[model samples]
Target: RRSVRHAYCQLCDEAFRSQDTLRMHLKGEHQDRYCDTCDQARLLPSSLFGSDYALKEHHVQSPRHAYCQYCDRHFRTHEVLRQHYREHYVQSPAHAYCQRCNMHFPSGAALFDHYRTMHY
Candidate 1:
């Protein structure tokens, strides 16, 4: 005789034949981690995923989240903002150039990397 096993998801009370499948359900579907709008279970459960997918897809398509419209580049965070400004400051000709390379860098991090490899 063969034994039958059932796996349960605590969040949605959904059951699956395998524990791994049930875990995936809890993590992906119930958690709303993938698509934010689809998080609502009361809404229609279409075989096709809807708005949630669309929103995430749109965010991915646009490269710039914290975007400078003039530069057409997206920044990872606020600290990057400071770094990017350095690029502008140096080009203004007021800032001192590095002694070794005579090349300008936008941020201290960029300048550090240039000095370490190029100068050394």
Candidate 2:
């Protein structure tokens, strides 16, 4: 009889033939609700299952996650939050206001087309 060695996950009691598969399982199933502090300390699957509110509360209490009140979204970092703000709030502008022509357009695409044709 031949025996096969496999990587085992202690958290879920799952085993895989390859380490990569075990890692993928950990990341996909467990890391989604992980705690930043606990994760830094090598703690896997920090939050309990079916505790999304608890996870959200943890993020709100922690400084690592950036929360946007306007959009009601959470970002992992300040750079991501800035990028989101620029994309959805600042660069796009209001639906009708055009930055280049200093006028109002019926739609944002129309303003973009005006800028492309008239300004550019």
Candidate 3:
């Protein structure tokens, strides 16, 4: 095979060294996902992913999605998340909010946990 500059995966757009490596990646990483066709596909199978919820968590937490799983809401932009947190924390007396992270929690304990794991 001739040397090439880069080989891109149609599935996830991840670049590889060669076509063989890309084929290997597709057969391994792409095959493990719940979807068979496309890496961008969001169809999840409970039977296969019953033990692992990483993808599900990623869908909610990933900034690219502009979604807030805690509030069960979707925003137009990721910046809306900060606005939502500010409004929610200010309106709800029982809720806890972190200004630095622009995130809200149901309770102070949850916020503390976030601080310990993420910040401290």
Candidate 4:
């Protein structure tokens, strides 16, 4: 027989086959952090994801958000995402540049790769 893995929710005394389901359950009665507006939203049992803050962080970084909590903004384009570091955003001191857009890379290899993939 194959063993099954279960994630137990302490809030409702229920066990789930997937931790994702348990996380989904957090948006139920006890906590409202989960976005019901999201297409993935579904009804599931509740509780035990450590804390509401963790859930908030997870939601903020999820596909629905596409946000940078550090910058406190949502990036509409990949070019903006690549220039996330505020200092290197549109030319401050970073040497990397691809025609109007300024981006910062940790190494020369990354910069070259970006140029080849995006500019060339």
Q: Against the true structure, whose TM-score is highest?
A: 2
lDDT (0 to 1) per candidate: 0.49, 0.61, 0.58, 0.53
Tell me the alpha-carbon RMSD of every candidate: 13.8, 11.8, 10.4, 12.5
Lowest lDDT 10-residue stretch of candidate 1: 33-42
Question: lDDT of model 2 at residue 83?
Answer: 85
What C-alpha lDDT does candidate 4 achieve relative to the native structure?
0.53
After superposition, the stretches of candidate 3 with alpha carbons farther than 4 Å from their true spots are 1-39, 42-55, 97-120
lDDT of 2 at 76: 75
Worst 10 residues of 2 by lDDT: 34-43
Q: Residue by residue across 50-87, what tens digits does model 2's lDDT show?
A: 36666656656667778653444787778988887667
Candidate 2 backbone overlaps, count: 0
TM-score computed on alpha carbons, candidate 2: 0.40
Report the lDDT tens digits of candidate 3 across residue range 1-120.
855548887646788888667767766776545332223433336434333355555556555666554444656677886677566644563667665577878765576577668864
What candidate 1 gets wrong by more than 4 Å, as runs, is 1-64, 89-120
Q: Looking at model 3, report the run of 10 residues with the lowest lDDT sum.
A: 34-43
Count clashing residue pairs in model 4.
Answer: 0
Top-lDDT structure, candidate number: 2
lDDT of 1 by residue, 20-119 (tens): 6765675577544232222223233542234654444433454434433223344676477557646643344434345455676655556556655775
Q: Please give each candidate's TM-score.
A: 0.23, 0.40, 0.34, 0.27
Winner on lDDT (1 vs 3): 3
Clashing pairs in 2: none
